[model samples]
Target: MDEIVKQSLVKWPNVPSCTGWLLLDRRGNWRMRDEAAQASGAAGVAIRHEALLGFINRNYEVDERGQWFFQNGPQRVYVELGYTPWVVRLSVDVDSALALHDQGGGGFEPAAVFVDEDGGILFADRAQPARIAVLHDHDLEIFSDHATLADHDGSLSGEFHWNAQLALPLQGIRRDDVAARFGFVASPAALA
Candidate 1:
């Protein structure tokens, strides 16, 4: 959390939280959901300012209820997730490593990785502070080179093919079960 945001909490401690106004899209973009956008059921407007994006990223946090939010000064603007809490990207510095760049900030340590029926790769740490996350689509190809990937039934193409000889104890699970199984809410109950 940023010092300024921390100070705001102390200065105006009772500012009610704001929800349905901010969203972290699957592609790792911060979106602002306005009244019109919400009514129209759109993905809302994209927030393109670098400074504000950095500020939100710096102050992003999750409450005890597992609701991720951006502490915009004093107001807790809960974010609606497009995938999991964090979006893992392929590290620019490394050739075969993944980087977590989402509400939880940088770096990821996925104990297990699996592909959803829709081809989205899911990572679950299952530790004390477990993270049920999705690897960014753009970097999926690079990840295929890892010897532990699971692509049985020969459904995958190119480097993502199933190689029982190099499998890594992979398992299958549903995306909707992520919150309940991992104890986090993707979309929390509306605030009164």
Candidate 2:
């Protein structure tokens, strides 16, 4: 992991989830990838970086420690790390929509979107801590987890970390829906 990513993970130890990096090529194909790992390294095994890449391409069965990387044709993306309990940070390059979900409360809710200094989009909400599910077109589920939004300044730059949990199943979304604007839903939960 990069120094900044590592630092962010250290800052927020409670959120265990995956991090993603997305890009859209001129071909009109959307590319997305993400990394998942255990926050405390106890719930499941941790996947090696290279192994995670292999699983993404081969569609291999992954244990809790495995990470994933994927590309929708011209769109090239990879999840360098599997699933963790911490937040998965993302750096988006365009104006995108995010869909969030609240698993604890059981349903999808509205979320907020912001731009970072790098021009990346940050989708988040702090009103309630909940499990989040993000979909681009009501079909492809790009990201999902239990996350808590943090305070953001106007800078819309730099990396921010939050506490999150990865508890969504991979098959939650279908694979054939047209790519639509993404949205986020939140369901608050009580922490033990």
- How close is every model to the real structure, measured as TM-score? 0.82, 0.19
Mind giving the per-residue lDDT tens digits that candidate 1 earns over 103-171? 336666556666566777776664578877777788776666553453568433222222223234455
Q: Give the TM-score of candidate 2.
A: 0.19
Q: After superposition, how far is residue 73 of candidate 2 from its true place, in Å?
A: 17
Tens digits of per-residue lDDT for model 2 on 60-175?
11222222223222222333221111122332225443333321122243344333233323233443442222322322223322222333463322222222222221221221
TM-score of candidate 1 on Cα atoms, chains taken together: 0.82
What overall lDDT, based on C-alpha atoms, would model 1 receive against the true structure?
A: 0.71
Looking at model 2, which ten-residue stretch has the lowest summed lDDT? 183-192
The per-prediction tally of clashing pairs is 0, 38
Clash pairs (backbone) in predicted model 1: none
- The per-prediction CA RMSD against the true structure, in angstroms, equals 4.1, 19.0
